[model samples]
Target: MRVTQMLIPTLREVPAEADTISHQLLLRSGMVRKVAAGIYTLLPLGNRVVKKIENIVREEMDRAGGVELQLPIVQPAELWRQSGRWDVYGPEMYRLQDRHGRDFCLGPTHEEIITSLFSQEVNSYRQLPLLLYQIHNKYRDERRPRFGLLRGREFIMKDLYSFDKDEESLEISYRKMYDAYNRIFSRCSLDFRAVEADSGAIGGDVSHEFMVIADTGEDAINFCSECDYAANMEKTPCHIHEKELVEEEGPLELVATPEARTVQDVASDLQVNTEQVLKSLFYNVDGKLVVVLVRGDRLVNETKVINYLGANRLDTADSEEMLNNFGIPMGFAGPVGLREKTAVTILGDLEVKCLFNAVAGANKTGYHYINVNPQRDYQVDHYGDFRVAEEGDPCPCCGAPLQVQRGIEVGHIFKLGTKYSEAMGATILDEHGKEIPVIMGCYGIGVTRTMAAAVEQSNDENGIIWPAAISPFDVLIMAVNQRDELQAEFALNLYQKLKRAGIDVLYDDRQERPGVKFKDADLIGYPVRIVIGKKAISEGLVELKWRATGELIFKEKDKIIAYLQENLTAMKSSKR
Candidate 1:
């Protein structure tokens, strides 16, 4: 594509709303433009990048035996009701009523629709296993969408679903999808890891997220230093190092804390270790008021609480409701005196239960109970792990300290089993004539997010350093000055030669300054750049520069095509 003919709206300044590097650069580089807050219009460059990423996902899925088929983006509410997700899918789904007053929703996912299709079509054991996939736009009304394509409400996605006869057959299907995911990301040249993750609202027992490592990522991952154990921080299991309880348990005594409200304030004012303070948090979990206790230094993982209770939603208790209904102030809530409020259930962390002589609130203003023991001082309805896993905590599998990493999730695969099929009654007849629900597995790749993540991990200060497989173009041919006859002739010849050799080449033939052309070339981040200068053209040679490595080599005009072909072969082999 010629620079003069194509729409590469390069910008010299960054926009105010662009926060992350990918977001800032894509906008400044003219790859994308904002349509709304989390929505964007993909310009020519951005569209090309997204298409390349989608093609990679398509190739890998097809190789894994997936048949391509498109599903409806707008689904009937009746279908969701059959899967019991109509009310469960919360506010993220965009719901609407047609003119006839039938409820419908823009699909954030297609599980219910796909399952309903399978239930009606496949009813025999002969079609025991099936792999189907589609690439399309997904909708989600993100409460606070940011980071450009990373969290857009309307974004391109590749979703694949598998149907199998039994658990063993489902395992095979899951493995195939997992292997395909690895190849898809690998082909995109992403620096990523596949970590075990919670199945969130997808309602599965096992899941894994493919995360691209970046400093600006939103997801936190915990990896063991000594083993292959890796998982999302919210899902990582902790082996709490047991500390000996105070052998001589001290007596519980109430003291005037004056104005100590926060855990830090109370710990510092009383001159006690923060670990000795039991921080209490009141929550309204699915309409049930629950009290939770954790170490002062630890944080509550709300996902663990939500999954543990099997509730669709979890929220903190309203400050006004707590004070008005239970006479418990926000910062002063504790288990003590809550026995009178029988509606409130108390759940404590496993370590909190064994703590002795801990400090807790008196459930009143400016008062606290010191040397407070768990069983004697306060009652706990249950004991379990409720705190977020932190760095330096021992891994559940290996007793080594966990290393925390920041990563952007690009893909996820789940062993959904019969969650959707059973709910929707999607069953097939067995060989013995017995009917059974179809076992399922789901796989998804955020195509646009993967492209943005590639920019996140691979770019430098200049611009995006795209990989050869997923770059908008493999090579960029530019002349020092389009008006210079020798330089222009050499550049045009090289461009045509590379194109004939099956290389995707971008020819910059605009009458622009050499500096501007070079800057734009670097910003676009084509893998290989071939420069035709007055000196090289006179010498029958051209200069080749590596966008990623910043290495420059000079080759004769006749042999440069051969050199590029050889380099491209090596690049393809390395991705494999």
Candidate 2:
């Protein structure tokens, strides 16, 4: 492709709305443009990158026994209702009504549609272990979409669903997809980890998220320092670490705290370590008021709480709600008299059980209880792991200190069991002629988000450093002076030769300065750059530079093609 004839609208200045590095570079490089707040128009270059990623995913999926089939982008609301998720899917679903007043929605996922289809089509165990997949657009009305394609309201995705006869078959299918995801991301040159993750609304007991390692990522992952254990912070298990109670079990006594409200404030006023205080937090879980207790130094992992309670929604109880509904002061709420004030359920973190002679709220303003003991001053309905896992926390697998890092989730695979099949009645008759629900697995890769994550993980200050396998073009040939006949002729000839050699090459033949072309070359970030300049005419050599390593070399024009063929293949084979 010739730059002068192509629609490459490179921008010099970064846009105001582009906050993340990937978002800024994508917009500035003219690969994508904003269509709306969380929607974008993929320009020619951007589309090429997305298509290349899709091809990789498609090839891997096919190799894993997946059959490609397109499902409807718009689905009937009745399908979701049949799966009992119509209302449970919440506001993220793009719900709409037809002119005839029937409900429908743009699909955020196709689990309901696919399971329903399977129920109608397949009838026997012989047809089990089926894997169907598609690469298409998905819509979700994100409440606060940001980070460009990473959290877009509308984006491209490749989703594959597996239907199997039993849990064993489902396990095999799940492992196949898990291995395929690893190959797909590695082919894209992503530095990623398959961390154990919470399934969330996907309704699965086992799941793993392929996270691209990046400092600007939204999710925090805790990985074991001694072993292979790694998980999303929300899913990382906190093991019980028993601590000896230094103080004897003293009689509980009320102490005047004055205006201390926060845990830190209470600890400071009382002259005790934050760990010596019991932090009481009230949450409105599925409309039922619940109080959770943890060590003051620990933070509540809301995901754990939600999963434990099997609640659809959870939010922190506001001050007004605490005072008006529960008759408890916001900052002075405690478990000592919480049941008397309101018959709310109380949950305590496992670590809270080890605390003896701890300080706690007095259930009255400007007062706190000293030498408070669990099961003595109050009772807990349940005790579990409710605190967030921290960096130095012991690993659940090896007991080594955990290390924390940020990462962007690019793919996810789930062993869905019979969650959807049973709900939708997707069953097959066994050898005994008895019908049973099919086991299922779900796998997904965000095509467009993968492109953005590549930029996020691989870019430098100049612009995006796309992985070689998915770069818009493999090589860029630029003439230092297009007006100079020697430079222009050599550049064009080399471009043609590379193209004929089956190399994706972009030729810059525009009437632009060397500096402008060089800047654009770096910004667009082609894997290999070949420059025809005075060296081409004087020494019969062309200037070659690698975008990734910035290695410069002078090669004879005759040998450039063979060198690129060998090196690009090696580049594609190796992960970044």
Candidate 3:
């Protein structure tokens, strides 16, 4: 492709609206442009990169026994209602009404539609073990879309749904997808980890997210220092290590703690460690108020709380809400008289029970109770692991201290069991002739998000260092001086040769300054660059530069093509 013929609107100044590095570089590189708040239009270069990534995902899915098919983007409300997710998705789903007043929605996911299709088309177990997949657009009306492609409302995705007759068969399909996802990300040259994750509205008991490690990532992941155990922060289990209380319990006494509202403030006023202070937090769990107690140093893992209570929604109760509704003090709330005061269920962390004569709020402003023991002064309706996993926390698998890192979620695989199949009545007959809901598994790769994540994981100030396998063009052929007949002739000839040799090469034949071309080339981030400068004209050598390593070498003109052919091939096939 020739640069003069292409719409490569490389920008010198960063756009003001671009927040993330990927978003800024994408706009400046002329790869994509914002069409709306959460929508974008992919230019030629961006489209090429997306297509290449899709090809890699498609190949992997096919190798895993997936059959490619397209499902309707506009899904009927009845399908979602049958699966009991019509209101569950709520405002996130893009809903509309047709001329006939029939309700429809742009699908944020295809579980309901695919399961419904299976129920009507396949009945016998012979048709089981089906893996249907498609690379298509998904729609979600994000309440606050930011971070460019990372959290876009409209984006491309490759989702594969597996159907099997039994749990054993489902395991096979799940393993296939798991292995395939590993290869796909590896091929894309992503520095990622497959961590245990919550399925959320997807409705699965077991799931794993392929996260690309980046400093700007929104998700925190905890990985064991001594083992392979890694999980999303929300999913990492906090194992209870009960410590026997050594101090004897004493009578609880209320004392003046004026102006000490926060945990740190209370600990400072009492001249004790934060761990000696009990932290009481109120939450509205499915319309009921509940008090959760943890050590002052620990934070509430709301995901764990939601899973434990089997609640649809969980939100923190502020001081005003507690005061107005339950007649409880917000900043000075405690479990000692919480049950008697409001009769709200107290969900206590196991670590809290280990404290002896702990200091706690008196549920009254400007007052605290010292020598507050768990069973002696207060009662816990339930004791469980309710704290967030942090650095140095013991790993559930190996007891090693955990390490924390930030990562962007690019892909997720779920062992859906029979959630969708049962809800939609998608059943299959077993060899024993008994009708049973089909076991399911779902795998998805965020096509656009993965492209953006690649930039997030691997980039420098120069521009985006795209993986060789997914770069828009494998090599860039440009002349330092178009007016120089020797350089132009050589660059044009080399471009033709590279094209003939089956290399995706871009030729900068425009009448532009060498500096501008160089900056644009680096910004666009072609993996390999070939410069036809004085060296090519005088010494029969070309200047070769690698975008990733910034390595520049003088190569003989005759051997340049051969070197690139072998080098590019290896770069694309290299595993992570």
Candidate 4:
């Protein structure tokens, strides 16, 4: 493609609204244009890159025996209702009325549609273990869609679903999909890991997310550098250091703390470690107040607390609710000496129960208890892990040291055993003519998000350095002075030669200065750049520069094409 004929509007100034490097470079390089808050129009350059990624994904999916199919973006509300997600999905689903006044939704996912389709067609267990996939547009009503394509209301996605007759077959299908995901990301030149993840509302026993390490990512991952164990912070297990107790008997006494509200302040006044402090928080779980206790040094993991309570939903009690329930302010609430008359369920952390004498809130302002020990002063109904895992903590798997790394989730695979199939009544007949629900697995890759994440993970201060496999153009050919007829003729000849050799070439034939062309070339970051300038033309040679290594070499004009082809082939072979 020639630059003059294409819409490559390179910008000199960055847009104010773009906070991330990918977002700024994509817009400034004329790759995409924003149509709405989270919706964007991909220009020619962006579309080409996305198409290349799609092709890579398709190849890997096909290698794993996945058959591709196209599904409707707009699905009937009845399908969701049948899956029992119409009410459960809440506001994230985009629902509207059709012309006939029937309810419909733009699909955020296709579990319901796929399950319903399979139930109607497949009947026997012989037809089980089928994998179906599609690359299409998906929509979700994100309340806050930031970071460009990373979080969008409408974007392209590749989703696949597997159907099996039993749990054993489902495991096999899940492993196939997981291996396919690894191959897909590896081929895309992404530095990623498949970390254990919470299934969330999807309702699954096991799931893993493919994360690419980046600073701008939203999810926090706790991984062990010594072993192959990693998990999302929400689901990561906390390992506490057990402290030996000092045998001493002191009566629990309430002393005047004098305006010490926070745990640190109270611990400081009492001359004790923060671990010797008990922090109490009131939560409203199903309209009942529940007190959650943990050590002052640790932070609460709300999901674990909710799971321990066996509740579907929970929220921190408001100040007014706390005052009305316990007649104490928010900061001064405590679980000491509270009788069973109060409709509050007490949950204490293992660390809190193991403490000898801990300082706790006195239930009165500006006062706290210094010698209060659990079971001696107050009692809790249960004890479990409710603290977030911190850095330098012990690894839950092999007892190795832990490390924290930030990563962008590019793909996820889940073993969704009958979560949707059973709920939607999708059952099939076994060989013995027995009816059983189909076990299912879900796999997804954020197509556009992977593109943005690649740019995020592989870039320099100049711009994005896209990998050769997924670059919009494998080679960039630029004539330093297009105005000069000799330079223009040389560039055109080289462009045709490269194209004839089956190379994807972007010919910069625009009448621009050498500095502007070079800057733009580096900013767009094609894997290899061949420059036809006056000095090189005089020597019957051209300068070749590798974008990733910033290596420059002068090669004969006839040998340039061979050099690029050989280099690309070697890089790909090394990856395998």
**Top candidate when judged by lDDT against the true structure:** 2
Model 4 lDDT tens row, 349-386: 88887887778887777888777887878888898898
Measured against the true structure, the TM-scores of the candidates, in listed sequence, are 0.98, 0.98, 0.98, 0.95
Per-residue C-alpha lDDT of model 3 across residues 1-576, encoded as one tens digit per residue: 998899988999999999899999999999999999989999999999999999999999989899999999999999999999998887999999999999999999999989999999999999878999999999999999999999999999999999998788988998999899999999999999999999886787889999999989999999999999999999998887688878677878999999999999999999999999999989888888888899999999998888889888888987787888667887788987787777687898889989888899998889999999988788888999899999999999999899999999999999998888899999989899999999999999999999999988778888989899999999999999999998899999999998998989999999999999999989989999999988788889889999999999999878887899899889999975
Quote the positional error of residue 238 for candidate 3 in Å: 1.5
lDDT of 2 by residue, 18-99 (tens): 8999999999998999999889999999999998999999999999999999999999999999999999899999999999
Off by over 4 Å in 2: 243-246
Per residue, candidate 1 scores C-alpha lDDT tens digits across 86-142 of 998889899999999999999999999899999999998788689989999999999
Model 3: how far residue 198 lies from native, Å: 2.1
lDDT of 3: 0.92
Candidate 4 regions with alpha-carbon error over 4 angstroms: 240-244, 324-326, 337-342, 573-576
The reply for model 1, stretches above 4 Å from the true place, is: 241-244
If the candidates were sorted by their lDDT against the true structure, best first, what order would they fall in?
A: 2, 3, 1, 4
lDDT of 4 at 112: 93
Error of 3 at 47 (Å): 0.9
Instruction: Give RMSD to native, each candidate.
Output: 1.3, 1.2, 1.3, 2.0
In every candidate, how many clashes are there?
Answer: 0, 0, 0, 0
Error of 3 at 415 (Å): 0.8
